[model samples]
Target: MVALRNLLTALFLPVKLCLFVFHHRVGRVRAARAAGDRGAISIELALAVIVLVGIAVAVLAVVMRLANTVKGKVPTDPVVTAAP
Candidate 1:
């Protein structure tokens, strides 16, 4: 259980760090746009959203496929074994 917890923490840390960085970057871009820079903040936001949505959709597809595969492998009924 300790090992499992450590593994989960290790895996989750990077994802959290990435999200934090993305948020920070977006905030900075927004601040720059607010400061009257003739920048492509809209384009950057659109691209980021598109990429995130694409990743989400891809992950959903993979999860659905895995769920279906596992469901297909499960027995529909309980098995009976004779007592020794």
Candidate 2:
């Protein structure tokens, strides 16, 4: 169970870090908007899109890994039906 916990922690660490950075950037964007910084909003939005895409790719990779693991554990067999 220690290994599982470690694995889970490792897997989620990057996601958590990404979320924290994204949150910080959003806050910065909001502060800039409040200060009447027009171009900063566009730059912030572009940065946000890039971060979101990274997060999405990371999530997709994790999901695909999980799917492959599950598929490997499933049994493959042909069903045989008997008629009375």
Q: Highest lDDT: which candidate?
A: 2
Model 1 lDDT, full chain set: 0.82
Candidate 2: segments with Cα more than 4 A from true spot: 51-84
Assess each prediction's global lDDT (C-alpha) against the native: 0.82, 0.85
- Estimate, for each residue in 3-71, the C-alpha lDDT of model 1 and write its tens digit: 999999998995997699688877978797788763577677778778878987998999999999889
Q: Residue 46 of candidate 2: its Cα lDDT? A: 93
Report how far residue 58 has shifted in candidate 2, in Å.
10
Model 2, range 1-84, lDDT digits (tens) per residue?
999999999989978987897798778878888998979687768977887899889989999999998888676655669988
Q: What number of clashing residue pairs does each candidate have, in the order they appear?
A: 0, 0
Q: Model 1 clash pairs?
A: none
Model 1 segments more than 4 A misplaced: 14-18, 76-84
